[model samples]
Target: MNMMSYAIVSVKNNSDKLNALLMGMKGVVGCDLFAVSYDDIYTVVSNVKGANLIADKINALTFAGVIDTLAQQFTLLPVRFGSLMGSADAIVKMLERNRHEILQNLLKVENKYEFGLKVFCDSGKLMEELRLKSGAGEKMHLKPSPEIKNSVYRDYLDKKLAEHRLEESMLAYVDAVITEIAGRLEHLGAVNNFKKMVSEALIIDAVFLLERDKKAELIQVVKDLQRQNAGLRFILTGPWPPYNFVDLDIK
Candidate 1:
C-alpha cells in the first residue's frame, strides 16, 4: 500500500519518546500512525492507497494542525503534502540519505516558531488615495503640440501611460509599507520572508520565524501596524512549526 506522509521529525536523543508520542496519536482520516527512522530523525507517516490519498487535503489547514501538534513536542521538517514513499523502509533510507541536512535544520528551528501575515487592501480605494497624494505635486505640462493632440491613438496611449504610472506608484507605496513593517520587526530580531502584491486584495504576504516567546509582542506589533495603516487589513496566523523556514530538501 502507498502512504500519505507529512514530515520527518528530529527525535535527536529522544527517539523513544517520539515513538511513544506516535503510539497515542492518530493519523489524518483514520490512517495508522507509524515511523521510519534513521538514527536520530524519524519520518512520522501513515499508509494510504493511491485512491485513498484523495481524501487527504493536500495543504489543508488540518495538515498544519497535525504538524503543529508534532512540532509542540519535537523538532521537525514539514514535508509538502503528497510526499509518499512505498514503505517504511524506503522512508528510513530517505532519512538516512538526508541525515546531515535534517540535523542541521532541526538545530536551526529547535526552539523557534513561524507566523504568517497577510496585508490586504481595497486596490481601487488605495489607488484613489495615491492619486490624491500624487496630485499635490505640480501637474505635468502637456502643451497642445502635435505630440499632445487628442487623437484616438493619442488618447489610448495616454490612458496606458497613466495606468503604467499608477502601477509604478502602487508598487512604490507597497514597498514603503513593507520597509516600515520590516523595520518594526527588526527590533524583535526575527527572520522574515515577504512577498508584495500577491493578489489584488493581498498587498503584502509575509512570514516570520522567531522565538516562541515573541508571540504576544509580534501580535502587538501587527496590531500597531494595522492601526497605523487604516486602509489596509492585516491577518496574522500562527506560531507554526517553521514550515516556511525549513531550508532542507530530502535527497
Candidate 2:
C-alpha cells in the first residue's frame, strides 16, 4: 500500500491528540487517515493503493481539506498535494532523514498565519491614463512649431516609447506599493514573498506569514492600503496552512 502525505506536524508529545483528530476526518479519496511519527514530528498521511490513486484536483483538494482540519489543531508544514511514498515506513524513513529541516520549518510557522494579497487592475483604463500622461509629456518636449502628427514611423516609435514609459511607471508604482505594504506590515513582523505583474488582471500576488492574532489588524491595514491606492483593487485572503512559508527539502 502507498501513502499520500498531507502535512508534517509538530506533534511534540501529542500523537494521541493528532490520532483522534485524524479519526474524525478524511483524506484523499475519502481514505482513513493516520500518522507516521518520529520523536516530536508527525506526518499525517493516508493509505492509498498505488494503482488507485489519481493525482487530480479533487484528490488535491481532499488532501488540502485534511491539512486544513489538521491545521486548526496543530502548526504544520503542508506537504505538497501529490506527495506520496511506497509505504508508511518510507514516510518515516524520509522523516528520519529530513527531521531537522522539518522541525525547523514547523518552529518557524508556529502560531503564524499565512495571508495572501492580490492587487488587480483594469488594464484598458490604466493604459488610457498612461497615454494621456505621455501625450502631455510629448507636447511639453516638442518644438514650438507644430510638428506633423502623421509620420507612420514616428507614430510607431512614439507608441512604443509610451508603452515603455508606461511599463516603467507601473513598475515604479508597484515598488511604492510594495514599500507601503512593507512599512505597514513591519509592526506585525511578517515574512513575505511577492511577485509583481503576474498578469494584467493580477498585478501583484503576495503572501505573508505573521502572528495569527493580528489577522484583524492585517485586514485593516490592507483596507487602508486599498483606500490609499486608487484604481487598484486588493483582495486579501487566509490564515492559511503556512503554504507559502514552509521552506524544507526532504533529503
Best candidate, lDDT: 2
Regions more than 4 Å wrong, model 2: 141-150
- Candidate 1 is scored at a TM of 0.90
Model 1 bad stretches (over 4 Å): 55-62, 136-138, 141-150
Total clashes for model 1: 0
Q: Write the per-residue lDDT of candidate 1 for residues 1-251, one digit (tens) a residue.
A: 97667787877688788878878777666677777777867888888777766644553565666677889988788888777789877887887887888888888887789999999999999999887776544146322348656687766776676677778899999999999999999989899899999998999999998888888999999999999999999999987888888898668
Candidate 2 residue lDDT tens string, 34-75? 888877888888888877688888877787788888888899
What is the lDDT for 185 in model 2? Answer: 90
Q: What is candidate 2's CA lDDT for residue 120? A: 92
**Which residue pairs clash within candidate 1?**
none
- Cα error, residue 34 of model 2, in Å, equals 0.9
Per candidate, the number of residue pairs that clash is: 0, 0
